[model samples]
Target chain A: MNSRISAFLADRLPLKNVENHIKKPLPKHINWLFSLGSMAAFLLILQAVTGAFLAFYYSPSPDHAYDAVNYISKEVLFGGFVRGLHHWGASVLVIVVFLHLLRVVAYASYKPPREMTWVTGVLMLLIVLGFGFTGYLLPWDQKAYWATVVGVKIAGTAPVIGDFVAKVLRGGEEVGAVTLTRFYALHTIWLPWLAFGLIAVHLFFVRYYGSAGTPKNTPEDMRSGKPFYPDQLFEDAVAILILFIVLASMAIFVPVPLEELADPTDASYDPRPEWYFLFLFQLLKYFEGPLEVVGTFVIPTVGFVLLLFLPFLDRKEERTSLLKRPVALTVTCLSVVLIMLLTILGAIAPRLEPVPEQPPAAEQTAPSQETPEKAEEEAVFDFGLD
Target chain B: MTDVPEEGQQRRTFFKIGMAAIGGLIGLAMAIPLVGFAISPAFRKASKKWVDLGIADLLKGSRYKKINYTFSAKDGWVETNKRRSVYVTDQGDGTFQVYSRVCSHLGCLVRWDEGKDQFFCPCHGAVFDSAGNVVAGPPPRPMDKLPVKVEDGILYVKES
Candidate 1:
């Protein structure tokens, strides 16, 4: 049976070519850290599959979007599990992509011929963020609505064509039905298409240039590189299995929550972006008004541009070692620390004020006779009920 | 090699063109409804109209009363009953000020703090005076006021 199956595959396709590709030797230093890229790829597939399942039940309209989601969670079989996987998978994909980029940076894998790979990887990271942002609005919940409003508003703060960009993003002057439908289309179709295309290019470059070995590995160690099929592939498979278990456990135990339906007219909603975006959200707090453009556009743009061109910026011929690259190490460490600090601050930061004490209904029924100064003073100091 | 027969070559050319034309027609036939279905939502206009909140007498005196009204909003193929809330304060003199419970900074619900003679948003520390003016916190504007009308003892609010 095996012989016949092999014979049929040989006749129909280039099995030998696939074997040659898969059996190529990888660097001896390639370990679990190197598996992060594969894990991201695996998670992308998982997201697409689970998202497709969700798309079957999800309604894109503002009116039915929330109901549809609720129905899926409460009515459909294992629908909540699927949604949970997709949600958690998306969050994990962001982390995996970031860690993969960090691993590449630490190994100086973005050097020389690997520049295009690094560029494609960075684009993939942005696409993943695009996925997160667009997907957040799909649930049509209060959190999704408010966060999107703030997000679109931040986009509206850009210099020159900011309003145009914001209008295009929201599909109107405000976050309404049109905005929800547009975000749904982008999340389910356009962004995923772009992600897949970029992934193809990224994989092609990885295959073309080959994997970069850790600088710590000796020349002899490099010479004894193991075949990818049983060695590197084994480690990657093990890592993916562990990731699947973790994701499944999370899905079963801590399912994603659905908040109240989005009400644009509601003014009291507190808008907070996703945790991955908390850094940018926190950064915006420091720069107000005209300087807001700095946090919203200039800084992020500069940071991304610098990242995209890091391979060109760090032109060095020496062996790739983080210890030898003080500037790169320092910059990377600082960025990681800053983002972590900002995210922590964003999570823990208190709201502007506590809930004010409510006065008795009878006292409220009576018209206020106090002067404007007294009223203002009462507003400031009186946490106690009247 | 001998030259091919003209009739046979012509027949082959005709078949190729015929096949191409048929394929093009089939593609167009398939694309019309598919594309239309895909982008139909973009052309949909928002379905919004004034919803009545019942008798105006329910909102008497200077006291603020929370009123809930339900309206059916249609978006594409789906229809849903949307619940809306407004804080109605009768000015004792005949006029009424209807404030939406939504906070101005974000879209969270705001409750009237009668003690402070203002509206307090729990999501943020934004405070709005009874008249819906921004009194404190990070709220960029005061609470929004819905257009209200009293016709034949019925209070109606224009919602969009």
Candidate 2:
């Protein structure tokens, strides 16, 4: 029976060709750090699978979005667990992708033939962030509404075409039903398609050029490289198993929470972006008024552009070690430190003042008789909104 | 090594091109309706209807009275009965002006401040006078006034 199956596969599929690709020798220096990329890929698959289940019941309108999510979590079988996986999986994917990038930089792996691979990886990271941003609004809760308002407003601070861009993003002047629908479409359909295509290209490049050997490895280690099928594949499988256990444990212990349904007319809610965006949020605090555009757009754009073209910029042939590449190492260290510092600051920043309690309706009458000075003293305005 | 015949090489190239073309055509065919279904919500228009609030006399004098009205909204395959509120202030001249409780600046509900004699938004500190003019805070405009009518002493509001 096994022979018959093998014969059927050999006749229809390129089994031998696939075997030739999978059985290539991998560098001996490949270790746990090298598994980050594969871990991220595993998380993406988890997200797609869990997200498909979520999309089955999610309603993308202002009226029913919140309730649908509630129904899914409380009513649907194992839906809360699936959602927790997707939520935590998204965050973990971001962290793993960042770590993968860091590992590549630390080993000077984005040199020469690996430049295209690095570029595709960067695009994937951006796509992951896009997923986070779009998915945040899917729950249609208070945090989603207010955070998205601030996010779109930040986009509106761009020079020349900021208003146009913001309008296009919102589908109107405000984040309404249309905005929810648009975000839902982008999150569930467009972004995933883009991610899948980019990931395919990224994997193809990895297969074509092979993993960049660690500069820390000796010549003897390079000569004693092992076949990927059993050795490296075993490491990858073990790492993935560990990741699944950790993610499942997290899902079981601390499931994702749902907030109150979005009330656009209520201004009392505090609005803050997701943790990954906290650095940019903190940066915006330092550059207010006319210079807001600098923090919101220019700095991040320039920094990312520089990082994207780092291979071309640092065109040295011999220096592939961290110690040898002082400039690159310093830049990487500084960027990581700056981002961490800003994120910490943003997290600890004071929240907007809470909405003052109102007197019970039964006991109150029109304050038409109050003195202007007393009324002024009693009035509370939202500082964050301004 | 001996090179393959020119005719065989050309045939292989043609076969590869034809296979890719056929595959692409199939992919396009499959994608059309799937993509259309995925993005169908973007093209849907929000259905709005005029809901009756009942009894214009419920709103009398200069006082703001909160009233709840529910209407069904259809979006794609989901139909939801959305309950919304509006504060109707009687002008004392037999004319009624209905204000959406939603603050003008961001979409927070605005409450009438009996002590301050104005509509105050707790979310952003936007203050509006009894006549619905922005007096202080970040509100770019006054409170939104809904299109309201009184036909045979019955109040009706246009809501989406």
Candidate 3:
């Protein structure tokens, strides 16, 4: 019966291709770190599922946005859980994608035939960040509104096209009802589609070239390893399951913070971007006045362009390991260190004043009222979830 | 006889061009309007109005008062009350001076630092003197000055 069913499907589809993939050879040297790719994929799927659930309850208009989010947390069943997964999942996805890129660099996997893969990987990183920036504004809270204002304004500092980019982003001169809907559409529809297409192209390249294996190993040695199905894939599944457990626990125990509705004219409110953006925020502090474009545009654009064309620039075929490539190793280490330092600095940097404690459920809609002094402090760590 | 082969090639080339032209036209038809619809707001100019800050008596003191006011404006499909604040000082003369709180560096709100007698932008540490001129930090220009006028004892500032 199984054979007959297989034969029936085989006649209708390319079963041979699927079989080949399932039985493909993988390097025996594969370790826990190699599973990071699959872990990221797992998180992406989780985010998509939860994000869809959110869209069901979420009304994109500014009038209902904060209230809709509040309803999701308070009224809907499993709403907080779904939203928490998406919130925490975004942060975790950035870290996982960063580490994956780092791992590839360390292994020199971006060399030669895999150049396009590296390029796509870099593009996906930007897409993930785009997802974060656009999604941050969905809550329509004070931080969401102000951060987007700062973000769009930063985009506007890019010389000639700056004003136009800012206009397009805000959908006008201000971040109002139009901006909210635009970000909602982008966060839910456009970014997801872009991510899906990029992932498809990235995976195509990955499968076509197979695993890059270890820098220490040759093709013959890599081929002598185990078949992927019950070997590497089992490990990948284990890693994904462990990550899912951690994610679900975080979702259950920790409640996502929904701050008060955004007051656009609140001058006292100290606005900070999400943690993933803190580095850029910190970097902007250094470049001011006539040189502001250097921080806002030139450095970032140059860095991204350099990363995209790294494979072509560094064509040392045999210099795979870190020991063989001193310049590459140093640059990678320095870049990572600088980013971490900047993020830490950005966090500890003094604000004009501390953001007032989050108001309770009752006072959420009344924007003009002062937040009560005896507010819950647990919501303080809620800063980094986006 | 040799022209027969060349004639077939010509017909094939013609068909290829014809099909591509049809496809291009169809693609452009949808793409043009779709793109226009998506970015229509960027090209739109937000309407500006003069908002009254209820009587010039509030600006009697030497210190700048951070006055907040809400004006009903049509933002996209919704008519909502947009709140904005400006620092208004008596200028110690017959005329009153008003400065917009938006930092010239980025768009972060600037707070009036009474202790320092200047305006401080918390985002990048930009400072502007009471007169709205850049005093320190990365602000390329002075704090934005608004067009203010008094009519019937009411002070009004132009808001966009």
Candidate 4:
């Protein structure tokens, strides 16, 4: 073989590298659960690549944004496909991540030495959430705008520093140019860079420790252990294949959500969080009334803290958290409450009612019969846009 | 799904742990609106945008003039009243010229002097020709013009 091929075979980054790094056999009994890591990686890569492409066409303006993206879908080559790819990629990333997280949890993988990895994993989850938040604003349509309104409002619920938090996020008391510019910068540049760095550290430690052994037992014979070779490669390849099919199928069929032009002044519009946030959205409802703090910062905040502290809390000798019933049960109970609360709150949240303002613009109304509710419903004061 | 303990570990004290969890979840459930309601207003401050005044006949041909107007703006919680002024003239075509009534030097309001046929910024010894160009003063640049757009018979000028 040529020297180039020889060098290529020397690394583990490519299939060619598999030749140089050939070693003992893998666990012949490896299951679908073991393949989730590669699948998550596949999805994350897709999100980053597709997100970069979509960024080129997306306008971060409250006024022209919807039209700008619409123009791309109609005008730019493959714009719709790329946008679809991005949309599905986000969902894929979240799903795959959760699966990866669960696989680790289910296997009782967050043991000693792997503690840092566990903490980093939680950070990765938060980064995914951050990605979701910032990306929502990129479209700048009514849905995105109002969703942001609710988001900022929720953040405002942060106790003593509520207004300050809101202002810091908004660059003022409300979302506008300043907010758009900040989110755009943070989304495209800041957060991604940080995520990439954190991911590198996270992955380095993961590999440094070796692919975690499954809960049952470690093999005594070295030959029985899996090498990061053909066996793993085959599974990873299969995972990539499955990921592609799912993303493509969703992209082709499910038209991405597109809202009307961004009208922050449109009071009737209700803002809801993205699907991933739906669970948390549902949680707030139960926290309503006297226990508002529990809904606001207390619960989700505590859950997030628990997620971070999992490594410290679950430091047991067993493999599956199943081995340590109490700790596992506690975490499980927390997750259940978190998800259940989210569901209830989401169901209960009154559709957002814009603070009653002056009526809608006359131009928005049809020349036909203008009924009172239609007048009321359609009537909105101009927040001053062309 | 709640985490299920191992089959072997499922026995004993189910009620105790269950009750504590139920309480914790309930407590969190109660805190939502107390936070949502309060933070919402402070979270909502105000939004403002520059209004495009279609066209106002506030300008007279090549003459120093002071035009005054008041307008209302919705600022989240309050409607703010605004005041504006400008000196107007004819700038080629159908467009008329407009300039700040405030002097370019120190922003003191300027006045039209029919006697010299010029604009005078009395507070700082500043002077301007009829076209609202600074004749002599500590001004760094010429007087700023407000954007004007005329639609129908009404003339409106930019608030900025």
Candidate 5:
């Protein structure tokens, strides 16, 4: 008992102090890729907190969903800002997670004890995407409604399992009241709980391995240098504090948009999801029918599986950056290309563009060539139909 | 005993360094809004000031008049000009009833048709009775009213 207590107290208690949290210096080479992991986690909290509050005012019914969103924006205090942050936060979070994953690949930070970290991160990325696709349908506005119609149609393209997946997401043949409730449940309860559990698993790896510092590009990584307790903790704390300030500033101002309520019958509004999903939208466009089958499902799935195997596949003799050749360069090129492609596709992806709506074709000009009696008869037909 | 840089040693040095860095950051965050709050009055003068549109006597029944006003908000950036109209009628008890000419349906400028004894929406064919009640057509709601107060024979509107 005496020895154990002594061990506990003698542990320096450095884990809890602000000084220990900030003073420990990091390796100089940490880059933008390294920064996004913290940013992704930051956005998750932002989304969760704002989303919980929004749930307080929102209703799940088809008729009321749009109105409720509008009411919160117009009638409720600070509701606009909360709503905006959740929306914009989702867009930005997806971006940061992609960068985080790319950094893991480029620096080969996913090597060794870090491979599971990368895998869990990929799962998190997909889950984030799940959150986004489901959440897009919640407002039940024209854009959200129709954009998701297209999205579900594409989901229905997945061979053997397409209909089941589509049915589960929509809760029926068409998106209706049941779909909204199902999505609301997924958004507010099921997805978040699943996300929390997955996040805990993901972060446990972080805590176990500590942060990978930078690319261990030299022989020195083979030797012990610094204990992670103080240095890494400090860096993580600084990131967290900065994130807190951003959240506070955003909460104070940039409230979310509650557009004129989501009306499914308002067929004129063209549906578009938040910008990040535009690549997938573009991919679906580029490939039609058989090719589309490969583009949407087969290709992305295979690409993701390939990415999972990368650490094992590139088994060179050295962890040294100077020794590593083609793999490093390939990783960098791939990250840049994918990001650019996704961004551009997001821009040009054909949305369910507003149908042309030709304005009832000008009342047929009363058939000027017709005799007066026939014209009179035709006019009577118009009136008679009414 | 191990040889050391001092008694409180390297740990004390790290603590002092950290405190200064963190204190500086937190101070900077606090200072930005403090400065904004301090100069906010000067910011207000550089922009627009709310203009009062006068007592009910100047307004009349069945006529739409657009009155423009400017609101002073925050610094160097002046707010854009604003416009609204007042329509007033006799309530028969020596009191006058007034309503804004703005349509609640979609913020289109509502026209008072004295001949028709109704308010007409040129955009969507919405018709309102003399009392701003929807009598015919597609307005899902009634007209919005502006709050007004009279002080010493002058009228003032509530602006946010």
Candidate 6:
């Protein structure tokens, strides 16, 4: 009966093309390192599933966002595990994606026909980072609130378009209700759509050009590449299984953190960006005044643009081995080391000390012209409040 | 006969232009409101208000007094208390200095350290003196000072 159903479905559908894609060939030389992309893809799927479950209970408003997240963690069955998977999944995804990029760099896989694939991969990386940035603010905790405040302000340090960038990011002068809605929209809808399109294109390009086999492989080795069905598929599954085990273990063991509710009036709270962004945060401390643009804009922009055009810049066709490619290897090593060092520095950085509490001052007996209710009403009218 | 080909080409060009106009109209129709909706907050002016701190007599002090104030403000769809703190010191000339707690470098709130006699930024190690001048660290300039008024013994600080 199953065979008959499969035959019936296969008659009308493009099942043959799907079969060919599934049974595609990959290089025999490819090892465990080659599974990084698949691992990242697995984690992304895990994130989407976990995030959707969390969203079923999550409220986006500033007033209820924290409470909603708290309810999910404390009350909802298996909710903590889901949230933990999402939290650790994001960090793990970043690492896997970075390692994938490094593997490509090491193998000189971004050359020639794979250039477009590399470009799309880099874009997907940015979108992944965007997911992290936007997702960080959903908890509406002190950490989320302050981190976003500082993060948006960093964009404000840029020259010319800085203020506009900051304003658009915050959705106003400060990180308030508008900002939360904007970030929530980006995290859940807009960014995911963009990422979907990019991922599709990236995968298409990878399929089109086939795997850029190891630098050590000869033409004969490429010609005799193994079928992806059993060998590479098995390897990919193992890598994904390991990743899942680690993710699930962490999810079950480590409960997601929910700090005190966001308090804008609390001046003593020190704001720090997420660990993935700590390198950039630490890098900003080196530049001050007019030179602030270097840290905030120039370095990041120049680095990204360089990465985007790396395939074109290194035009040599004969070189592929890491041992032979001195410049690429050196640049990769330097960037990795510098980023790690900066992240470590940022993690251990001292914060502003708390001020001593003072006695309460006398209260104002007379009412002000702009009463609380009146101020809210006027603001609602001005903002076209929903 | 030669003109027939040119006429055909002209007709094709006309069709192309017509199609382009239709496409552009569709795009504009979708884009106009979408862009406006997304960026409307960029043009939003923060609701400014004069918060009543307290009576002027009680505010007259040698050291800066930390005062917390709450005002109703609209944040997206919710109307809630917009809480903020500021350091105010009587300048002894019947004027008061109201320095914003927000650091000038990034937006991390600065705290007044009684031991150091200066404002210290928690995010970065920025230090500002009693008069709001930048003492050290990465802060570009002095701390921000807000407009202050004393009307009928009530001390009011203008906040945006």
Off by over 4 Å in 3: A1-4, A354-386, B1-160
Clashing pairs in 6: none
**Whole-model lDDT per candidate:** 0.81, 0.80, 0.82, 0.69, 0.67, 0.83
Indicate which candidate wins on TM-score: 1
As for lDDT, the candidate ahead, 3 or 5, is 3
Model 5 TM-score is: 0.61
Q: CA lDDT of B105 in candidate 4? A: 83
After superposition, which runs of candidate 4 have C-alpha atoms over 4 Å from their true positions? A4-29, A219-223, A321-327, A337-341, A344-386, B1-160
Candidate order by lDDT, decreasing, is 6, 3, 1, 2, 4, 5
- Cα lDDT for residue A152, candidate 6: 92
lDDT (Cα, 0-100) at A103 in candidate 6: 92
lDDT of 1 by residue, A285-363 (tens): 8988779899999999999999988888888945577767998889989999999999999988876553345644654
lDDT score, residue A74, model 4?
A: 54
| Model 1, residue B72: C-alpha shift (Å) | 14
- As a whole number from 0 to 100, the lDDT of residue A333 in candidate 6 is 92
Q: Highest lDDT, which number?
A: 6
RMSD of each: 21.9, 19.7, 23.5, 18.3, 15.7, 26.1
Candidate 4 vs candidate 6: the lDDT winner is 6
Residue lDDT tens for model 2, A195-266: 999999999998888887788667566545665665566566567767877787787688687889888777
Q: Write the per-residue lDDT of candidate 2 for residues B99-151, one digit (tens) a residue.
A: 88888899988888778889988997889998899999999988889988888
lDDT of 4 by residue, B124-147 (tens): 788887766778877777777777
- Per-candidate TM-score against the hidden true structure: 0.67, 0.67, 0.65, 0.61, 0.61, 0.66
* Residue A364 lDDT, candidate 4, scale 0-100: 50
DockQ per candidate: 0.02, 0.02, 0.01, 0.01, 0.02, 0.01
User: Candidate 3: global Cα-lDDT?
Assistant: 0.82
Say which docking band candidate 6 falls in.
Answer: incorrect
As a whole number from 0 to 100, the lDDT of residue A31 in candidate 6 is 77
Cα lDDT over the full model 6? 0.83
Q: How far is candidate 1 from the true structure (C-alpha RMSD, Å)?
A: 21.9
